[model samples]
Target: MNLEETYRSLGLSDAEYARVRELLGRTPNFLELSLFSVMWSEHCGYKNSRPLLGRFPSEGGRVLQGPGENAGVVEVGEGWALAFKVESHNHPSAVEPYQGAATGVGGIIRDILAMGARPVAVLDSLRFGDPADGRVRYLFREVVRGIGGYGNPVGVPTVGGEVEFAPAYTGNPLVNAMCVGLLRVEDLMRSRAVGVGNRVILLGARTGRDGIHGATFASDELSGESEARRPNVQVGDPFAGKVLIEACLELRRRDLLVALQDLGAAGITSSASEMAAKGGVGIEIETDRVPLREGGMEPWEVMISESQERMLAVVEPERVEEVLKVAARYGLGAAVVGRVADHGELRVLCGGEVAGSVPAEYLADAPAYEREVVEPEYLKEAQRLDVEEIPVPGDFNAVLLRMLSHPNLCSRRSVWEQYDYQVRTNTVVGPGADAAVMRIKGTKLGYAVVTDGRGKWCYLDPEGGGAATVAEAYRNLSCVGAEPVALTNCLNFGSPEKPAVYYQLARSIEGMSRACEALGTPVVSGNVSLYNETSGGAVYPTPVVGMVGVLEDVSCHATPGFGREGDVVAVVGASGRASLAGSEYLEIVHGRVAGRPPEPDLALEKECADRVRRLIAEGLVDTAHDISSGGLAVALAEMAIAGGVGVEVEVGSGRRPDVELFGEAGGQILIAVPGERWDEVREALAGVPWQIIGRTGGGGLKIGGFVDLKLEELRGAYGRDLFAEETG
Candidate 1:
């Protein structure tokens, strides 16, 4: 290929090329062009979503480190802190499911480790297309296997996460990974290389040609020929990853490093340039000094290869020997590949020759586009569902059975069974719960975390859907008796150049930010994965929120299952106000994906959630779960199925039975209290709209005297296997 083709193939526009030339004030070499190509791409530069992301509330009392870091850190309690973040590997997962997902998990772990914390737990949120399709089924299996393959061996507990299936993800699946780590507040690390003349170390894995142009590749749309892009997906080594985690944490413990950064996306170019920019200094990297796994790799190849299981850090010249000694003891590759310089320019050297040089600040700051978002005509139509015209099911019992067995609502036991969730023994409540609660070992304090999003809702109403996403996560944490603190997110959208996609992007951010401000759960760190479009169309805007809540005492949290037969069941807040818009029942029974999702009342949401947390803290509630998705009826059935018992509940007092029974309105919670504390339940929920539905009991589910089904039948439908049905 010629020079122009080479640069264009890297996803850089001609205008951007001209800007690079202007910055350098001269014609550029291939090395300089490669550097700018990946550094300025959407993956590294966040050229499209950066301005929109600024709308999120990113400040709170617990946030120690916010955006621009490898991961965000929040103080938990008693001199301990938690570092967490969520990142997406969507395009790669669609192209090469196994390696793409494995490396995604590996990448997020390194991010947590870079903050000088011991990696503790992992959670993932996945979205796939119609499960009945053979290709989508294959992708689902391989992706889950890949997640378990890497996480199980790394000794990090693969706890709880959510998976949903929809047609919007037919050819472009999203695999977003989240990792949580524990660290003493004093041991927190930063990526700012403060001192000039400090030596930069390349630790762990070696550079190769495996994942060249990965950042540019990820920033584009997929097609039927996406398989041809498989080589752009990096391979992962879980064993090497586990060792690197240990080696890096050991380095931090010994205070042998001044700064650390994980080598991901654009690899060396992004890591070095970003560190230099953040530190307000310069970095000079020698490609000849970099350890390589392949022969005859070009200078640009070494600079941009997205090799897996690697870290970049800087240390004082006098402490370099100790760092090298730690690397040697761990049986890993390490080399002094660069040095901090006072020139304020990122200079590339190879075999004592200059290959490229650019101002670090200019390289890190890409031009942000201010796109005008025009609401789509299709969205206006989609939001115009006439609820009164839609037919309600004749048999509520049969409808409940169908909703339970639907692919979107079935049990995920087969998926979570593949993961090793009991590793490290910190997990108090793992999968099959509202949130995964992990203890702080010797102390009574703990933390709860969950990943949640509803793309179908976002497709209907971006603003309301976005706000509801944050609100649902907040309520989910509160159900488990944890106080919501901060969150990390993965905003997956389509091409922002498209007016409709930009509208979804902007409105979703605006909505979620407002919710964050209301709930006081600020965004700390996040990732934006765009261009999730195939020839079919853009995927639904999926803004997955990874929220963390703090627990004052680990031993005192509520599970989402009935513990006693005599427990009294009650619905709190606005249960009667539940509506069927953007609900699973609407799609499954009526075959429509229309209508606005429930608009969350942020003020009322926080008040109700706080009361629920108080109930759990005071030992007045036995079980708690939020009403979402399938709404009141499905929530009751799930609690019964989880506890292996039957429940008889009287619901749907005066409203339409179907909407009251299955509507997915926000700000409502279901809690079961001991029979004797019914008075206390009434007293605690005095200010909110609440009602005592019924009492938990016998061998069947009796809902509002209309829907009645055997517990055996309910469990059977809930556990029905979609894969089995598809294959049969």
Candidate 2:
């Protein structure tokens, strides 16, 4: 069956078919069909999600550029605006972790670069199966390596990210990458196919056969046999991508182009068609005019190929030569493959013969598809379970160690150490901090950044999941001593028409809205990627939230590491019991996976986050880390390991030792305050629940009324077993 047949099967109405036929002529061939499928697929097409995504609140005086283009931009003083975006590469990573993850990093960077911004930081939210599984291990290693390999080489800091493991993700691992960039508000680039009689230039990598039907590939479900579909995977060369970014940003500043877009997804065909359609103009392309990396390529290969490091530019007719000269100066490939036309038809010529022609709008505007929704059989069962019986390990100490060692809770230093996070001195607090801190030159103000998500929990409980992601990001920023000011998100989910999926999707949005409203941090901008499914089944609902906060004193930022020996240790905020709803502890350490993950109490979260930020700025808190994922035990252990010192703790009277030490609770922070400032610290948190849990001292970690472990032992849980494999 050809592409047209598939659309017909998708229940496209006669009007839609006639519109598509008008673009490709009488009857469409395989190539034309493939192009149609890609342009009309939900991912590139947004057939089902466009309506829902339109509901997000994206306008604000600070919003320099919102949603429709590459990444969102919001002004952040100092004559600067921040550009950032979060995106998912689930199917591809599950198929080929390394390259898939590498390209994901590559793509997001290009998005920021396309807007004339300099990428500053990158963070990833990863989900995998049990590490014991050989396949999962391989995927994990490769995916981490790929992210480090690409991001490190590009000189962008891979600062803060989170990892989680669950059985539900075994069949489809999730790799979501978010990139943040800095651009002068005045220099921001706009994407609209404007200007009449302009020259259309294809710049960067030459057209090739790679990812020939990639957009269609994304639209369909992944069969178990993904190895056979390697051809659909787009190969990445980060070095080339880095060069392209530099060239593009430089060229944009020189004012040599009218409009710009990165050639992603459906490649040349989609970019050109969408650009023209958005500008209400037509485009005429000569297939033979494209620059090719390999010979013997067909016209379709030139149009649909998803080659990396390529961009499209609409240049003023007279400035075409100047644009070509600038591209040449950068030693990049440049070609004028088409011309903007006054008519509204996509006219294509192959060696002077009209090979195909179509209405630009029809090819670009996919028919809105409504999906069948059936509640999953497991939803009710998942919510019906009683929480009173949630199990707590008898030997909580051993459990803490196990949880720390688990891939999800362990430290990510091994993965990020390979990255040069400090290359740009603007980075005040690098990878080890809760959020990546970068100084805004020429001003005392600085920015704190973080990205977060949890797919399984979000899939099971959309509202809670969505709220948790936003809260998690804010908590991270709080730990770094910043008050979150703005948020952006990349919503990744399965088919929206499925009632269960739509249910989750809608609740997640509601959750986000509530969290943002409560926190006083508005949603600046974001992107939505729906229809992320395979033949096996739909992926768990994954929504990544990227948030930025402000800190006037970058130098006072707190980190999750030990700062001084003999510093008094304190715990602030509420503490109760661990929620296993979507915890690695329940799924991995124990053979149980029931209940719900802890939900954030917006009121308590604000109090805790705000208080901690104040203390850090006042120089009363030496070090701090929010209690999340692995809870208090993991957070404390991470702090000790990072400081290369040990801690001694005395469990307070009333609270359960096990719960106080290992329970997963949000709105709580572990801090190391110098003895001199103990009184001041106590005064600062007056009227709020507080505890003098212990003190940081030389040597190993010691806990009273709880099972004990040495600081070195705790570090071993996250130091990585791979290091010994090579060192041994």
Candidate 3:
């Protein structure tokens, strides 16, 4: 290929070419150009979102290791630590849903395993187009199946996750997976190739030509011809992944590994170069020594191929034999493909011939662009609708019932049941709760996690939506009586080249930063996925927030179910009227996704969360559930269904019945307390805004004459399996 053709194929602009030339001090050969291309791609480099990602608070007392590592590690008491992260496999999922989604699970599991932790649980945050469309339905089914296929065999319980549907995701679906692992603080592994003479070992599956240029494929926008790029989607083997996890942990246990890193987006090129750069050392790789699944593969292809279920390890020269033994027991491929050197450059040799050499830092550190941000013109029209313009349903009961049956607000039991959520028996509280709670096997301590987002709200008001996303995740953790500590996010947005998408990205980050600072929860690790648009249009600016919190005593955590027959149900942080804008009520009842979502109050949110945690800790509340999406009524219905009991509530004369019942708002929670403890609960919440909205009861849910329904009726509406309904 000519020089210009080579540069274009490498996904480099003229300016980037100039920078590469200057950094190398000469023209790069084909192999060097290919390495630079994959490393500099937006997926690997974070060139567009890096500057904005810095806006997040990334340090805290509990954070043991933050953003710079393979995954974030936080101290979880009792000398144990938690390693976790959330990553996206969007573009690939759009092209090949099954393998794309399956590989996403495998990739994240490997990331957690790289930290020398045993992955205990997994969660997913998914978004797809309207299910009425055949293509969307097929994609949704396969994605879920894919997630289960990988996570189930790996023995990591798929505890909880969130899924939403919108028109914006029709062309390009999103699949973000999160994995959490447990290990002793001392057992933690770092991903730096520290020892100069350490042997670089390639572990697990053999390299192949599949998924070549996968990073560049992810960095570009999807088109009708995206199917032709299916070769860029890495196929995963869960059985191999499970075995690889075992081998790595055993290696760590035996002190055979000096450092470890997972081969993801850019494969060996990224893993090897990043390891060298992070440790301030150099690496020399013999491409011919790499175990390959396919013959006749070019040196560049072997370096950049994103084959799944593979990892790189820096092993002590003396322990190489032992490391190979463990990998052999697991039937995994292990070969010494490289070595750490003092030269500070990444050198590639093929057939004993030097093919490429470049400074490791140059490949690891890509340029960051400050894209122009302009507010979207559609925001005005989308946010113009007022609550008054939408008529209140004549029968509030019917409206609540309809909202309950809506897919976004309905039960996910059918979905989560497909995977094993209690395989290791560490799941204290699984799916269907405010957050998933898992005990740290040998200690009294446990951790709670939740993945949440609001695409409709974000589409209408990006700033409010972003703040609300973080605030809601914090509240979800608090409802389970856990103190919010840290978070990891997946920022899924449209192309950054568009000014509107750039504005959304910037404003959302700003809002999330403010919320994190207020809540004292730093963003420990995250992944940004841009260029999510198709020829049709860009998706709603969806920023999925995954938050983790700690529970000092696993026994003290609360669930979203009424524990007593006559417990007083109260609403906390319900100081203001609900906003109908950007609500399920508007979308389901009015058939419109318009209006500004209520602005999130960071101070109020923190206060409410703190007080709720205190109340749960003091044993003043038996159940706590955050009110969101479908608002107070739906929250009540969910709690009632979970407890198999009904509630009788007095909805005092309000502005509008529908608004009081189903309008969406943030910072509000429904708590159930013993009737005898009502006075004490009130005194404990002295300064907090609250009201005795209802009482847990027997057979029927009564709402002050506006609505009255049997417990079975409410259950029937709330428990309809959306997956079954849509697929059948």
Looking at model 3, residue 54 earns an lDDT score of 88
- Per-candidate Cα lDDT values, in order, are 0.90, 0.77, 0.90
Instruction: Score every model by TM-score.
Output: 0.99, 0.92, 0.98
Q: Write one digit per residue (lDDT tens) for candidate 1, span 1-728.
A: 98789779878898898888888898788888888889899998999999888899899999999998999999999999999999999988998898889999999999999999999999999999988899999999899999999999989998989999988999899999999999999999988876999999999988988789899889999987778988899999999998899999999999999999999999999999999999999999999999999899888899999999999999999999999999999998899999999998889999899888988898899978879899977988888878888876789999999899987888888889999999989999999888999999999999999999989898899999999999999999999999999999999999999999999999999999999999999999999999999999999999999999999988889999877797888877865567778989888888888887779999999999999998998888759999888988999999988887678887646877788787898898889888888897788888877878888888778987669999899988999765566621
TM-score, prediction 1: 0.99
- Model 2 over residues 1-728: C-alpha lDDT tens digits? 76646666444446766766775557765555556767887668777666566556676656777777888887877788888888777767877889889888888888887788988888887877666677877888899888988887877778777676665666778788888889888888866787779989988988889877766666555676667878877888877887788888888888887888888888888888888888899888888999998999988788888888899989898888888888899888899988889887667778998676667787877877555556667776765545456565677778877777766667777767766777677888877668888887778878888888867678667788788888888888988888787778878777686788877777788888788877867776666666666665677788888888878777788888887888888888875645555555555565565556667898888887889899989888858888777667677788888888888887665655555565565678888888998999999998777788888876776777575787777777777653222210
Task: Tell me the lDDT of candidate 2.
Answer: 0.77
Q: Per-prediction count of colliding residue pairs? A: 0, 7, 0
Error of 2 at 128 (Å): 1.9
lDDT of 3 by residue, 6-83 (tens): 999779989999999998889998899999999999999999999999899999999999998889999989899899
Worst 10 residues of 1 by lDDT: 719-728
Ranking of all candidate structures by their lDDT, best first = 1, 3, 2
Report residue 197 deviation for candidate 3 (angstroms). 2.0
